[model samples]
Target chain A: MPKTAFQRVFPYLLVLPTFVFVALFTLYPVTRTVTDSLYKPARRAADPSVFVFLENYADLFDSTHYLGARFVQILGNTFAFTLATVVFSVPLAFLFALLLNRQLRGTGFLRFAIFYPALLPLIGAASIWAFFYSDTIGLFNTILRGFGLTGVNWLGDPNVVLYAIVLLNIWKQSSYCMIFYLAGLQNIPRDIYEAAQLDGAGWFYQLRYMTVPLLRRTTLFVVLITVTYSFQTVEQLQVLNQGNPADRGNLLLYFIFQSIGERRNWGYVNAMTVVLVLLLLAFTLTNFLLFERRDDDKA
Target chain B: MLQRSLRMLCLLLVASLLAVTPFVQAQAQVVVDFYYPTAVDGPITQTIQEYATKFEAMHPNIKINPVYTGSYTQTRDTIRTELAAQDVIVDVAVMLATDLTSFVEEETIVPAQQFIDRMENGEAFVANFFEAFLANCRDEEGTIWSVPFQRSTPILYYNADLFRAEGVEVPRNVNELIEVAQKLHTPERAGLLMPVAGGFPIWLYQSFAAGFGQPLIEADPAKVYFNSDASLAAVEFLTKLGMPTSEGGFGVGPMGGSVWGDTPTAFTSGQAAMIYHTTGSLTNILRNATFEVGVAFLPSGLPNENGEGYAAPTGGGNLYIFAATEPEVQEAAWLWVEFLASDEVQSDWGARTGYVAATRGAWEIDPLKTLVEEKPQYLVARNQLAHAYKEFDSYRSIDVQLIINNALSSIISGNVPLSQAKATLDAAQAQIDSLLAEYR
Candidate 1:
């Protein structure tokens, strides 16, 4: 009844490759970045590298300094961008999913049309949008001027720039979220809707009662994906904003990218990264608690 | 059967080893990996490849690999990453001339002077480049760090059709600029477009500083004068471009400022009567415009003692050799650099790409001469070189650039009141001083 050597070692061998890769790529970099966050690079050839533990973090939030002002503004911009994108895109995606879920003529073509924006590279989409948003001689401006109205600066006004970018993000991302919602929709038993209809439930009632409750887990999953995506996108910002109009569009990831790419301020950026990771971790923990409690209640 | 299979495997392995021997022998030919950046609109990568092919045909023992890294900043980032990881992918690269300080600080580059010293006509080679173009290629102690290649200056591109219709003469100085712009201003068309709204405004802003008789930096990399009297005058003039005359402003461009990529398009379409853009964009704008385009020096804020009022900041990339590569590879890379900066190649590159040819000799050559004769606007940028100063560069240049950019943006974009302009600049100067304090 004793196990053979091959049998005993088979499971460990199976997990080893993945473990090795994770350790090398993910664990190693995370450790290195955390360590790097604590140390300032030597600014001069004669100077030694100095460890200033939490000072890097403090420098980011000290309002008397320029970095502090930038950090606060960028952090606010990132959060607002994330909140706006999620709030708008999720409902729009759900609507699209609901529409596409119904059996209709030309639904396949319509679905593809709706999903086409998601297929274009974000950078390409941002470039195309840049032409549309140009303050002078743009599509919107030309149309506005044709009607004898003043054309608004979509990308130039700090008040309107974030919303302009958010609109693009929604246009690009809603269809991607729609794909998930469509898949989630397909899994729901059709008979539930049919039964609700038999009980004289209206379309709104059916969606609110049967569909919404059934898709809680899917909605949760979609929210998590969208939130992560909102935090990570730097392409649109790079192409469309470049922190222009007085750096109003500067966001967390773009700030970090500028820090690393332009300034080579590794220590400061790493501290920023640590703060970002902590924020994301908080969100994930909240989601876990909610989902875990829901599952326990179901059981 | 097992014995027969084992013998077959051994035979295959030996055959593979024999196959690899010739591949290893191909290493006798030095392969130089050249990475260059394209900041302008054109088929730059294709042209570089064509040059590489020609270079290789001439020297069969050497191979050239031309890589098109994105922007100057992106190219620097890529190279920095390679150096940090000790991967050493690039043998030679085209980076911003202003990047000399940072690269030298990193000690990742071999000074171009060393290579020139070994050449037969080293002094003649150094003398070939315009003094203005060479400004960014030297350090505080005057060691040449890079060879100027795709060099440029910010010049004024005006809609000549609009100027003629409005009875506006070409602006020579600040007063003329204001007069011409105010006359040309209309509800439908902006009078001026200063493309100083984006991530790196310091390049264009430096032109303003120069016009006001205060170049941002000179021989000293540790020192910068962001809040000097001349710099303050420059900021005041810039801020006024977005304000109304009733408010003691020029009433020209938008208060929020204009985008870099959008400026050329706007000027061509007649949305703006004039624009300040890089000479690198000359070809694209000239080709696209339906109306006659007038190229002029950036209007001066104040004339110097010599009565030379015009001022611009020289820009664009320089070719540098990496120190990490093998000696033979470095030698090959130097040969490739020499070929690229040669008069014939410089002429072709400038004529095709609209860059001001780096060497004076290139300007006197065939295609460049032919192009200048056909479109005299091509000569305005080169003429402006007399008044051009070094682009803003200092220790920790990237950070310094961003600080100056933000400070300028805050002032010019009206985020901060004009009254606070000095304070903003002072703060930025203080920040840069602390950042560069160690170097001093």
Candidate 2:
């Protein structure tokens, strides 16, 4: 059957504006990033433009630098940080959410206390943590000194700085991630827990067996989100560490920020950004597929 | 009846005149969309807005609309993005003096001298800033692209009471700094503190390098001496200060971890006997310090073999007038710049805000002189002006600084061998060279 003119134009009309918007906002930048990464910018205003493909990438992979202080080391630290935050924060969030779900005195106030860090801006939170980490007047060190012990330089020490940030992030992220878990826990029928209890299952047993399996969907969501954010988090580093002393907290995002934003090395930052997006995409896809398959098997 | 009609006609004429007057007045007013960004302090914006209001009242024909962009970098990005959109988003802006090269590249801002050349007292106004500050605003061709607004230099702030208690004088050179720091070091107190986080190590080290009679940037903008013997010696001096207690680095204290404002916090808490920071921090330090705060010149640089001491590096931002073809808007921007640069405004700003008034005339003003008289601490930064050099600013300013800063951090923290510091600096020089070569 021959289609009318209206039919022929209908699909294109429907798709074109959305495509244009996406292209303007997203695809255009993505393409520009890819192309821009091929050329080095003229450093001096008077210099003519020149293309230097793959040179920026080569700089990243420079092998002459120390293993502990190289670009690869920064990437490794980013991954280690992301994984550590997820592993530690997600379960803690779940546990808190479960406990808060019970009708208990002070639970209302308790939820606010847990969730307040999420309310503060990330940099503000970092600053607060910096106060606690201060050697002279900081609570952590002051308390230690009162006991006749030497104070620790939490953010100053290379070995302890990353963990100190991680601890602050956990304190912050668990509060935020708890909200999602609370909503997820609400969806779980109370009957399952009551039925398990009737069968004389302990609270720990119920939490381990039923709660864990039931919260799988929530756990996947929490993991996906927390993982994505942990890799990109730069505020704490910018505020406290700035990925100092061997790029301890220099995530891919910060590397991009310092390289491109501060230095005008857009080509190198674009190259790094491309790699970062690909890694994140891979991570998201793996999580999505693994979870979706698990659900399919159960069904 | 004829007289009554004449009176009605007169009233109608008056009403019509009033109706037309507003439209004419609106057309007469030139609106200057100004972008002013303060990265360090938030309150400075309120002060700027008040100044804008005052300017508006004085120049009824000119209206100043001030937009407070978030940070220095954010302001640059926003202006760049705005200009890229083919929009004149701002007619005048306060941006980092070091950003002159980039603005010139984009043609987003015009040379202040271009506009200043026509105004009364223009030449003197252009030259009013401290010599060290004016250098940052000049291009290689000697065009003055911006006029100084907020300017500062590093100064030494120590606990006067602590020094007295310790029975020691303030450190004047590397030897004294180390010796005094060792004497002052305790489990509870680090003798000295200077921030090393992010790009600060380079910022503060410029003072040391200058005092050693080594300039970081050559006369040629394209060439820099980051890995030079002098800079290495400066870095080594810096590393020694932050060395472990066993290694005699008591001077660095817990400064490796503290960045920016925290250095002041460390000092005010009595954990640090002396600190190296900007004079901009003086007011905040004074307000918080429980003990007597002493302001002094930065430890005289590691004296050269000839016993010459180089000056401290001047740092801060300037006001750049955005390029506009419209004569009225361009003229209005100059008015705003000149007003902001006036001794009255500069003095008021200097007194209220901690930033040093950039204009030499501002220092001569009676109120400002009285301020210097009342708190001699305010004079330390100004006194260092004679010894001050232009800050190490180039086209890719942050990039170069970060490279050097990271190297210092590695030397101090990685406990890397001295040879490795050279390697790190060589890598920086290579990167900086690559960045500048195409333009050169």
Candidate 3:
């Protein structure tokens, strides 16, 4: 029995290296960030050793400075961006995966076409989109001008910049989500669909009752990953808009980066980072509570 | 069979380790990494690589690693974080003109005066550099913490073809320039292009403010002077051009429609009539432009009634040696700096690239002078240098610049009234004052 126990524990022991790597690389920095957030350190050259406690966090709420307002706005923008991405991308991915599964001619080519955007580096993709968003000499503006329509500032207009970025995100991420959805589709038992057909169930009925329920885990996984990535989206904002047109497109991650990277307000950036970690924790815990029960019920 | 496999694996491992061992030993070859930000396109990366290869060949004992670390701001952040980790990985860096003060405060850079004093080969290295370049390199104590590498000032680049077509005379002063711009502007074409983007607009406004005898920051360099009447007038003038018609705006400012995409494309493409851009853009313009380009001084906001012009700000990059590197490496780095700053090298670099040479002797070099005679744009930059003011480089200056830029953007977009804009700037000045107190 003890031998069996040791054998059972051996696999975990073998995986111990990965655990140590994660702790050192990920947990260490995160813990450091949390600690640093509480203390303000002088970041400039002349006076390098001054430390003030909790003042950095207090600066976050100093309304006159606009940092606090900017933070709240960025959070709202991040949530909106993530929610829109999930709403548009998840359904379209599922639909595309369904169509791809249909043994249609040139389906492989179609899949390749769909997957192309994901292959591009973020900056490269953003650059291409920035060209398209250019007020003059852009493909969109050219077409609009040809049609005698006024060219809108796609990036410069704060009202539309967020949506424009969302469009870019959808283009890049939907294909990625489709790959996952297609895998889930392929794993659904052929016999179950056959049984459904024998019972004279319609295609819609089978898809509604049989396909979606089986893909619940996949759907949950995609939503979680997509939301996490949305919070971390910096490249598009950094390259294309750079929080332009009155700082409208600024997201939380980019805001934190601007604080530390551009401004060198390390203490303020750390405090914001701690807040972001708390947000991520809250999101993960809520997701677990809501979905883990459903997963158990389904099983 | 297992013994044979083990013998083969051992042989493979030994071979691989032998192959890697030389590379590991090569790392011990006085390795010095250089971090530079390319102001131009990716082709500059090749130029940097060539410089590195030459340096390595000259000093066979040292291995030079050249890294392109993105924009100026990105390079600053990367170097800071690396230094904070106590990693003296970057032995040399190309820093923005304004970044010297912050770097010195962090003790991330060594004073260059000692290196200037130590050069071999009977070279009068420090004396050869342009006088205007010293304003940025010198610390508060008048110590040379950095050496000017690439120097540039804003100049007016107009499409001569467009001016001829429109029968508009080149403007010598701001008022005439605005009148010409109004006449030259077509809805289908841009009259001028001012970057409403961060920093560029502020720089343009500061140029005008400087011409009007207004300082961007106080003499102490501890507080912003952007809330002053002169600055307010400059902002008002800029905002009139940038605001939309619905907001009672004029249109895009000077470089607007005419400025090209990345290169001098807009002017070359006949999209705009005139452009105000850095002298560094001269080479790109000359190389790409098929049209006759007219080079002139930047429009003077406070031109004498007789149309005499005052100088604007000179903006560009400088090279700083880090204090943490070994003495030998510092010597090698200084060798590179001195070589680049030599009249022959500077002239060649200036002729090849659009950037003006940091050394004054570059103008006396026959080839560079010939290039300038052929291309009047080069001469325009040289003439402007006489009137150029160095941007403030105190630790709080960048933050102050950022604030001014943000406020200027608001003003230009017509989101804030003139009084409100002034009030906003006053608040920013207060913030700058606090930063100055804390840092300076």
Best by lDDT: 1
Against the true two-chain complex, what DockQ does each candidate achieve?
0.40, 0.38, 0.21
Candidate 2 CAPRI grade: acceptable
Candidate 1: tens digits of C-alpha lDDT, residues B206-277: 777877778888778899989898888888888888787889888888766688888998888878998889
Which residue runs of candidate 3 sit more than 4 Å off their true CA positions? A1-13, A43-53, A197-200, A262-264, B1-32, B49-65, B117-127, B198-200, B244-247, B252-263, B303-311, B414-419
Pairs with backbone N, CA or C atoms under 3 Å apart (clashes), candidate 2: A237-A242, B311-B387
Best by TM-score: 1
Model 2 per-residue lDDT at B344:
85
Give per-residue lDDT, candidate 1, residue B392.
Answer: 78
Residue pairs with colliding backbones in model 1 are none
In DockQ terms, which candidate is top?
Answer: 1
> Model 3, range B1-440, lDDT digits (tens) per residue?
99999999999999999999998877577766788887765377787777778767877777777888998878888987877677768888888988876777767788888876665733466677766677788876777878888777778888898789778888877777777877888766667765554324666677777766676753354556777887777777776664555666666442121112432566667666777787777777777777888988888777454444465677778988898898888877777766556787678778777788888888888679899877766887877777677776566455556556666665554445655877877776666666667655
Provide the lowest-lDDT 10-residue window in model 1 chain A.
A40-49
Among all windows of ten consecutive residues in candidate 3 chain B, which has the lowest summed lDDT? B254-263
Task: Score candidate 3 by lDDT.
Answer: 0.74
Q: After superposition, how far is residue B141 of candidate 1 from its true place, in Å?
A: 1.1
Ranking of all candidate structures by their lDDT, best first:
1, 2, 3
